[model samples]
Target: MKKKVGLYFGTFNPIHSGHLIIANYMVEFSELTEVWMVVTPHNPFKKKSSLLDNHHRLEMVYKACEDYPNLKPSDIEFGLPQPNYTVNTLIQLEEKYPELEFALIMGEDNLKSFHKWKNYKVILERYSIFVYPRISKGLIENEFLTHAKITRVPAPIIEMSSTFIRKAVKEGKNIKPMLPEKVWKYLDEMNFYK
Candidate 1:
C-alpha cells in the first residue's frame, strides 16, 4: 500500500508542545502515515528576519520530533528558491516522491487567508487539506470548501505561541512546559532569543 504523507509546513521558530500534540493527533486520528514538518526557509508575505535562523529552527524541530517515528523535519525548502511558495514546494515533492501521496496540513487560521496564496485553486484541487483549529474566528467558510477534501482534526488549542515564547525568553521568563526539554536545552546552550 502507498504511504499517505502529510506536509505540515511552518516556521517552527522553536518547536513547542502544541505542534507535537497536533502531529500526534493527526497520525492517530487521520489516515496519514507520516507528518513531515516542512521547515519553511521564509514565508513570502511575512518578515524573514522575525524568524529564527533556518538551521536553528530546523534543529529545534528535529529535537522536538525525535521521539515520534511519524514526525520528521524536512529541509526541502532550503535548496529551493528564496521566498518559498507552497504550490512550488508541493509540485517539487510530487515530482520527487511519486510513490507517496501528499496532503496539505494547516490550521484553520491559515485557511481564512489561504485564498491570497498564489494558485490557491490549483492547491485545493490537487491535494487534500487537513485543518486543525487555532484560537481564531473558527473554520474558514470559503468557496474552496465545496471542492476540497478538508478534514478537521481534533487538535488542542494551546494558547502558547512562538511569538509569546520568544518574548518570554527575552524577558527572562521560564518556558519549562511550553517547549520540549531538548529544544529548551538547545536554546539555553545557544543563548537563543537572548
Candidate 2:
C-alpha cells in the first residue's frame, strides 16, 4: 500500500497551535499517513505585502512541526514557480514523490472559494480533498462538487490564526498559548513580529 500524504498548503507566516492540532488530528482520523505543511511563498487570494519572508515562514513551520513526527513541514513551493497554485504544487509533489499518494488538505472556508481556484476541477479529478472544519466557517455546500471525492475531516476547530498572533505580539501581549514551545522560543529569541 502507498503512503498517503495530506498536503496542507498555506502561507504559515507563523505556524500556530491550531494548525498543529488540525494536522495532527487529520493523521489519526483521515486516510493520511502524514500531513505535509506546504509553505506557500504567496497566495493569489491573499495580499503579498502582508506576507512575511518565505524563509522565515518556512523556518517557523519547521520549528512548530518539530514535535509531531507525522507532521512534515515542506519548503516545496520555494523551489517551484511563484504565485503558487494548489494544482501546480500537487502535480510537482506527485512527480517528485511518486511512491506516496497526495491529497489536498484545507479548511472549509477554502472550500467556499474552491470554484475560484485555478483548474480546481483538475485538482479534484486527480487528487482527493480532505477539508477540516473552521470555527466560523460554514459547511461545504457547493453545487459544482455534487459528485466530488471530498472527505470531511471531523478535526477539532480551534479558533486561532497567525494574523491574530502577530497582532498580539505587535501589541506586546502574551501569545505563548498560541504557539509551540520551539516556535515561541524562535520568535522570542529573534524578536519577530514586533
**Candidate that scores best on lDDT:** 1
- The TM-score leader among the candidates is 1
Q: Report clash pairs, candidate 1.
A: none
Off by over 4 Å in 1: 146-148
lDDT score for candidate 2 against the true structure: 0.86
Candidate 2 ranges with C-alpha deviation above 4 Å? 137-141, 144-148
lDDT tens per residue, model 1, 25-64: 8988899999999999888877877788899999999999
- Which ten-residue region of model 2 has the weakest summed lDDT? 136-145
Estimate every model's Cα lDDT from 0 to 1: 0.88, 0.86
Cα lDDT tens digits for candidate 2, 125-190: 888889888755555555634646788878897889989998999999999988999889989998
Clash number for each model: 0, 0
How high a TM-score does candidate 2 get? Answer: 0.94
